[model samples]
Target: MISRGSIVVMAIGGALLIISIAHHSQEWMRVASRLGPIISVILDGGLAISLISAGWWLRKQQTTLTPDE
Candidate 1:
């Protein structure tokens, strides 16, 4: 039941999640030393989960709106 837009949204979310993790990891190692390890992990995890969930939710909505065969 997934639509094209939902697929695109999920792809975008996945890409963003990857990029954000990389960026945050580097920052945590080089600049966020004071924040320590756990904070960065938690922050990135939250972001990625939210993004993926949003895409999934969007897909669900799109499927619901369509007329069933």
Candidate 2:
């Protein structure tokens, strides 16, 4: 089973990823430009990696908790 904390973290990470991508659009670039490309890359990549890792961890935990039968 996935923990509530993991769910929350995934949600937050998903939201951040969406925001970062949306901000990359031409119209949204004006706002995203404030953070600049480098910072945005780091922020987005970090969030994506964290979310993926969390999900992988949760999956591993879930499998471990289940009975082989």
Candidate 3:
């Protein structure tokens, strides 16, 4: 079973991914331009994906290590 913390982390990551995609619009271009488009994309998307992966890994580890009752 997945832990609550893991679910929360994955949820936040999903939200971040959505925000990152939305940030690509013209209005947000100014912020991206300041950070550099490539770097901004990498930071936003990479971090989100990493968080999601971490949460999944945590859940897997928890399930594997726990004793089945």
- Among these predictions, the greatest TM-score belongs to 3
> Which candidate number maximizes lDDT?
3
- Report the C-alpha lDDT of model 2 over 1-69, residue by residue, as the tens digit: 556776676777778777766765533455645557657667776877789678668757866895669
- Using all chains and alpha carbons, the TM-scores for the candidates as numbered come to 0.64, 0.52, 0.74
Candidate 2, pairs of clashing residues:
none
Q: For residue 7, what is the lDDT in candidate 1?
A: 75
Worst 10 residues of 1 by lDDT: 32-41
What is the clash tally of candidate 1?
A: 0
Ranking by lDDT: 3, 1, 2
Q: If both were scored by TM-score, which would come out higher, candidate 1 or candidate 3?
A: 3
lDDT of 3 by residue, 13-66 (tens): 999988886785443566635456566667888999999999888888888885
Whole-model alpha-carbon lDDT for candidate 3: 0.80
Off by over 4 Å in 1: 36-45, 65-69
State, as a TM-score between 0 and 1, how close model 1 is to the true structure: 0.64
Candidate 1 vs candidate 2: the lDDT winner is 1
* Backbone clash count for every predicted candidate, in the order shown: 0, 0, 0
Worst 10 residues of 2 by lDDT: 25-34
